[model samples]
Target chain A: MIQAEHLTKRYGFTTAIQDVSFEVRKGEILGFLGPNGAGKTTTMRILAGFFPATEGRAIVAGFDVFEKPLEVKKRVGYMPEHPPLYEEMSVDAYLRFVATIKGVDRDKIDSRLGDVKARCGLAEEGSRLIKHLSKGYKQRVGLAQALIHEPEVLILDEPTIGLDPKQIIEVRELIRGLAGDHTVILSTHILPEVSMTCERVIIINNGKIVVMDTPENLTSQLSGGERIELDIVGPVENLPALLREIPQVKNVSLGEPQNARQPVLVETEGSADVRHLIARKVIESGLDLYRLSTQTMTLEEIFVKLTTEEETQEEETE
Target chain B: MRNYLAIVTKELRTLFVSPIAYVVLAVFFAITGYFFYIILGNVIEFVMQRAFQSQQFGAAPPPFDAPAAVIRGFFGILSTILLFLIPMITMGIFAEEKKRGTIELLFTSPLTHLQLILGKFTALILFLLVMLVPTIVNSILLYLLSEPAPRLVTMLVGYLGAFLLGGALLAVGVFISSLTENQIVAAVLTFGTFLILWVIDATAGTGSTITNETIRYLSILNHYEDFTKGVLDSQHVIFYLSFIFLGLFLTSVSLDSGKWRG
Candidate 1:
């Protein structure tokens, strides 16, 4: 439903986003993951028709964003980073106004209002003033405002930034539930949000797209090899050599000794299950195994590595 | 058109719900009411003196149009008061939206820039009309009680001038409001601009040179004077309309430029 081709935006000397290209299929939940100032918001703004890209083009809901902005705007609902709201107006009045501008049918406005309010968990808070609501409720009202028109595409920039743990879960669930009928492109610096909610993740950094793939693939591809962390309590001077003897064991390194227990990190090639062989080899030796667990690189480590690695490469080139 | 009405309704709701609207309305009514009372008192006293003088000398009192004099004085003061009050009404029209980040919602919506500008302009005009209600009623009451009523056409024309002048100033206020995210700054800038326009003719020397004539013609008050004198000069009407269009056109250009800068 959305296609951005080499879209770049520059504010005088600084480029907010440069040569960014991505496509989001109909009814797909695409997550844009980046640290702050990483052009996630800039890319989303371009797709939503908030501003024309300084170079290139965006096609949203089958309408060119620059040439047919109004038509694209009619089909795309945008929730900005701050949840653009009028604090003085009640929630219902605000949503109705948005619905009207989004070209929602006049006859169906009341029903659409009811539907969006319920969907965003804002049914009871509809009568309350927006400023009077809690932060979580205000966020929900923002979501409700975006959903009121039932647009084909939803562009949300940091949809769950300032919510409690439970509110965050509820919002993630709400976004996840929108996958089949609504194409969503939500940006966030939160790692788990992208893994939990998006079907495809786009990691952007410093005005460039580093990678775009499924969450599971991103972890596995960046990690290079499977890792097993072991805690052994016996004499561990020979543990590295002993673990390396197992077939397909690529390398073994010992961690610092703490309270007479030694932590060992084992690297194995490919996706093979070598834990049982390593356990048998440890038992044959005199070492007593206190803990044996395989660890995949978490999304947090992958994000840091991906974003930081690019900076070092740029520094080296400079 | 639907989008325009939607924006108009939304803006009106925003205006009415905030304390600023009520404060402006109350303050405007109080100040204008006080002036009306004072002007009426002066007019009544002057007419009574004329009557008494005629009775003493047995000569017809100098033709004193009490209602006309009252309207002239009331409208003159009303326009000046509007010069200060209009900035308050329009200062937040776009500034608050930019400050609160709602301008993103507006710019991204399906509505055109002109629709948004016109909607806001219409809302302020409607509120200005509401603000003029008591003044209109006051004049009608004066007409009923006075021995010689004010000329109805002239009175209507003066009110039109007030409306047009308010609208022209409001258009300017809207343009200034769009240039900044600070409401106070917008108000100050709008007031300063209107103040210059109000007294621009004062800069003209006592000469019929083309430069002097242009300066005198540029003063907003110079054109408004014709309406108060019961003359609906098309030139004045065209000038106000063109001024209003220029302000709105500049506002449109400003909005478009923002998109480019962003």
Candidate 2:
């Protein structure tokens, strides 16, 4: 539903986004993961037709964002970083105004207003002025405005930034329910949000996209092999040699001692089930197993790895 | 067209919702009312003096037209008061939106820049019309109280001139609002620009004849004089229309530049 080709934006001599390109498929919830100043908002604004890209083009819902911005704007609902709202207006009045300007049919405005207010949990606050609402409620009103027209694509920038944990979960549920009917592209620095809500993830750093894949793939691809962590109480010098004898075991390394027990990492081949064999071997070796846990790299670790890897690469080239 | 009307309504609601609009209205009417009282007082005093001289020395006094003397003079000062008050009405039209980050909503909607500008301009124009309601009431009372009825055509033409002049000034204010995010800055800059236009005629005699003529033509008060005289010349109409167009065109250009820079 959305395509961006070599999209670059420059503010005078400074480039906000350089050669940024990504595609979002229909009915897919794509999480845009990036650190601060990573050009995520800039990219979203360009795609939403808020402004023209300096050096490239973006197409949303089969219309050019630069040439046919009105068409693109009609199909996309964009909630900027700060929910663009008129504070003096009541919630009902504000949503009605947004629906009208968004080109919702005159006959459908009342129904659309009802649907969005109920969906965003704002039905009760309809008569209250927006400035009187709390931050979380104001944010919901922002979401309500974005969802009023039921656009095909939703470009939300940090939709759950300042909410409480319960509100966050509620918003996540709401976003999750939007899949299969709406193409959502949400950008945030929160890693677990991507892992929990998105089908695909794009990691960007310093105005460049560093990695793009599913969360699981990103974890495994960065780890290079499946890893199992082991904590045992025994002489660790011969553990590597003993664990290497197993057919499925590839490599074993012992970590530093803590509380009279040493941690060991066991690397296994692809999709191998060797935990049973390793537990049995620990019994035969006359060693006390304090803890044995199988693990893989997490999305946070992958994010740190990819972004730091880019920095080191630049340092090396320089 | 529906989008334009939607924006216009939305803006008008915003204007009425804020207390600043009430404060501006109060200040506007207070000034115009005080000026009306003083001018009418002076006219009545001048008439008494003329009547006394005619009775004592057997000299005839000049003819007095209450509607022309009071109404035209009232509107004349109304323009000067409008010069100060119109900026307050327009300073927040675009500047407040930019400061609050609501301009994003307008820009991302399926509305064109021209539509946005016209919608906002129309809302301010409507507010100006609403503000003139009290003066209209006062004019009606004067018409009812007159022994010899006032000339309706001259009064209508005079009010038309006031409306067009206020429209031109409002367009200028909108353009100034688009250039800044601070309302105070917008208001001050608008007032400053109008002040310069107001004083341009003062320098007419200091320069060469051709330069003096050009300066006199550029002065806002110079073109507005014919309207107060009940003269509906097309040249004056065209001048005010062109002034309004120039201001709106600059505002639209500023919006385009903002989009490109953003």
Candidate 3:
């Protein structure tokens, strides 16, 4: 439902976003992953039509954001980095104001308010002044305002920045439940949030799109080392020699000694798990394998490598 | 029109929800009450002196030199008060929004810049009306107490003129508010600007004695004079309308510029 082409934002001598392009299909939860000053917020702002892009254009729900901003604005709900709330007003009052300004139907406002409050777990606190609420509640109120209009697309920036772990899970569950109904593009630096909440991940660094794919795909693509650790009851010294014969095992290192047991980290070049073969080989070699543990590269490692501040190393290697 | 109503509601709700509106109203009434006290005291003195002169000099000139002098006096007094009052009410209209980051919500909404400006300007007018209530009470009491009786129509016209003048100044205030996110800067600059306009009006008179008028016409007080004399000149009407329009236009332009840089 959203398409950005060669989007760029420049301020004087610095470029906030540069030649970034991507597409989010309908009903897909696209997690925008990046660090601070990584053009994530800038890109979201352009998509929401709050600012015109310095170059190219963005189309949301079939309307060009720059050429027809009002139409785009009417169809997209955006929660900025801050909640964009008036501290003096109650949560209900603030949501009502947003609904009015967003051109939601007069008759549907009450129903929409109820729906949004329930969805964001804010049904009981609508009458309280926003300034008086805790930070987590404040962030939820911001989300509720964005959802009150019932727009087709939701653009949330760092939606869970200041919440406790339980609150974070609740908000994540709320976000996860939003999929299949509306197109969502949430930008956050938190890694597991994307892995848990998104169907697709777009990694951005230095104002450029590094890669776009499913989280599983990106992890595997960058998971260059998946090791299997074995615990045996036999000798530890002869363990490395027998495992070297396996074709899939590229290199192995005896893990630094730890409490009660010795560990090993393995790097593999093949797609198959070598744990079973290594285990059998150890039994045949008469070595005790006390522990067999596998470590696979998660989406976090992939994201860090993709969006790391060390841009040149990854760019040249990729 | 729906956009306008929505923004108006938003502005009114914001204006009433905070203590600042009440504080501003109270401050305005207090200052205006004090100014009224001094002016009433002086009016008593002027009338007494006129009475004494009549007894001594036989029908000495009536106190009013020309209606225009009173017009100038009323405008001068109101303009000075507005110079202080406009910024307090207006500095937060756009500046506070920018500072608190609520302007993002506003800009991203379906409402346009014109709607936002008009809504804020209307809210300011409502606050000004609230300030006018006590002034009306004062007018009624003064009418009952004065012997020769103040000119009811003249006073009514002068008050209406003051209202319009405040509207124009608040529009200017709104424009100034849009230029910065610092309320203090907005208020200070707004005061400085209106003070300069008042000084210009006092110094720059209708040009040559013959077929007069130069840059004195640019003064806000110059344009506001017709209303104080109970004269609703079409030219003055046009002038205030243009001034209001210019302020609003610039306010809209500033908001639009902010969108680009966001």
Candidate 4:
């Protein structure tokens, strides 16, 4: 539903996004994950036809964004980061106005309005002025405005930035539900949002795409090996040697010992289940095992590593 | 066309919803009403003076077209009043949208720049017509009171001048509004531009040189005089129409440049 090819956008000498490219299939939920100033919003804006890319092309809903922007805009619904809204207008009036400008059929406008209001959980708040609503409700109204036209593609920049925990969950669920009916591309600095809602994640940093993969794969691929953290309460001087005896164990390191309790970290190669072996080895060694748990690198760690890795690489080259 | 109407409707709704519209209407009506009364009193006073002089000299009173004089004076003051009030009407047209970040919604929508410009221009024109309603009623009242009613064609032509002049200024205001995101800045700049255009003929330096003639012709007020006289000169009509087109064209260009700057 969306194809961006080598999309580069520059404001004078500073490149906001450089040589970035990605594709989103029909009905797929694609998440753009990056730190601040990572070109996430810039890339989305290009795809939404908000502005032409400085040196690239985007085709949205099968229309070239630069050549036929109106057509692409007709089929792509964009919700900006700030949730562009008129505070003076009532929620219902605002949505209806958006529907009209989006070229919604006149007779079907009321029905479409109702549909989006219900979908965004804004049905009862229609008559209330938008400025009177809370931040979460304002965000929902923004979502409703984007959905009013039933466009084939939805581009949302930071769709869940300022919401309570429950509102965040509801918004994530709403976005998840939008998949298979509307192709969605949402950008956010929130890591778990991508994992929870997107089928595919694109991690961008410093005007470049660092990595792209499924959430599970991203965690596993960057972790190199699974780790098991063990808390043992016994003489632990020989624990690392004993745990290393296991065939699948790649490395073992011990934490500071205090009150006769020692923590051990065991790194194992491949995806093999080596926890039972480690526990058995600890028992045979006469070390009383108090806790044993497997720990995989989280998306947060992966994000920090990938983003910082690029920074260090640039420093090294410099 | 549908998109155009949609934008027009939206603009009208936004205008009426804001307090500025009512404030502008109240100010316009109050000032114009006072001026109307003063001008009527002056015209009546002049006629009574003439009757007294003619009775004293024992000669029939010379014909005095009271309604014509009143309409002429009314239109002259009306234009000056509009000179100040138009910026108030158009200052927020584009500036507020830019400030609130709704310009993104508009630029990304399926609507063309021309459609957006025309829709806003049309909405302001409609509101201008509404503002002129009481003045029209006042003219009708003046017509009814006179023994020989005012010429309907002349009254209508003068109104046409008022509408065109308002539109031309509004078009200029729209262009100025697009140049900034500050409403006050837009209004002040628009007022400044209108003032310059209003008095540009003074700079012609009393010379018959081509440059001087061109400068005199460029003054918007100079062309408006013909319409108030009920001449309906195609030259003045073309000038106002072209002036409107030029303002709108520059607005479209400004919008495009903004996209590039982004």
* Alpha-carbon interface RMSD for all candidates, in angstroms: 0.8, 0.7, 1.2, 1.0
Q: What does the i-RMS of model 3 come to? A: 1.2
The sequence of per-residue lDDT tens digits that candidate 2 reaches over residues B1-262 is 9999998999899999988889988988888888888887887788888899999989788788766787778889988988989889999999999999899999989999999999999999999898887787767866788667677777787788888889999999999999989999999999999998988999789757898988888888888877777777888888889999999999999988888777
Candidate 3 Cα misplacement greater than 4 A, ranges: A225-318, B57-75, B202-214
- lDDT for each residue of candidate 1 in B5-36, tens digit (9 for 90 to 100): 99999889889988888999999899888998
Better of 2 and 3 by TM-score: 2
Best first by DockQ, ranked: 1, 2, 4, 3
Return the TM-score for each candidate structure: 0.83, 0.83, 0.82, 0.83
C-alpha root-mean-square deviation, each candidate:
11.2, 11.1, 11.5, 11.4
Which is superior by lDDT, 2 or 4?
A: 4
Q: Which 10-residue window in model 3 chain B sums to the lowest lDDT?
A: B65-74
Candidate 4 ranges beyond 4 A from true positions:
A221-302, A305-318, B55-64
State the DockQ of every prediction: 0.62, 0.60, 0.51, 0.53
- What local lDDT does model 1 show for residue B139? 85
B1-262: candidate 3 lDDT, tens digit per residue: 8878877777888888777888877887887777766777776687678888889988767556333343346445766777777788888899999999999998889877888889889888888887776777666766677655667777777777788788888888999999999999999998888887766756655556432355576677877777777777778777777888999999988888877777
Cα deviation of A79, candidate 2, in Å: 0.5
Model 2 residue B142 lDDT score: 69
lDDT tens per residue, model 1, A211-288: 799988776655545678888888878777888887778889889999888999887876678899888888889788
lDDT of 2 by residue, A1-318 (tens): 999999999989888889988899999999998877888999999999988899888989999999999998898899988999999899999999999999999899999999998999998999999999999999999999888889999999999877877888999999999989999999987777888999999987678777789988766655544578999998878778888888878779888899998999897775668888888788789898888887644434546764675466446645
What are the lDDT figures for the candidates, one per model? 0.89, 0.87, 0.81, 0.89
Give lDDT tens digits, candidate 4, residues B1-262.
9989888998998999999999999999999899989999999999999999999999999788888888888888999999999999999999999998899899888989999999999999999998997788788888788868889888899999999999999999999999999999999999999999999999898879999999998999998887777778888888889999999999999998888667
Could you tell me which 10 consecutive residues in candidate 1 chain B have the lowest summed lDDT?
B141-150
What CA RMSD would candidate 2 show? Answer: 11.1
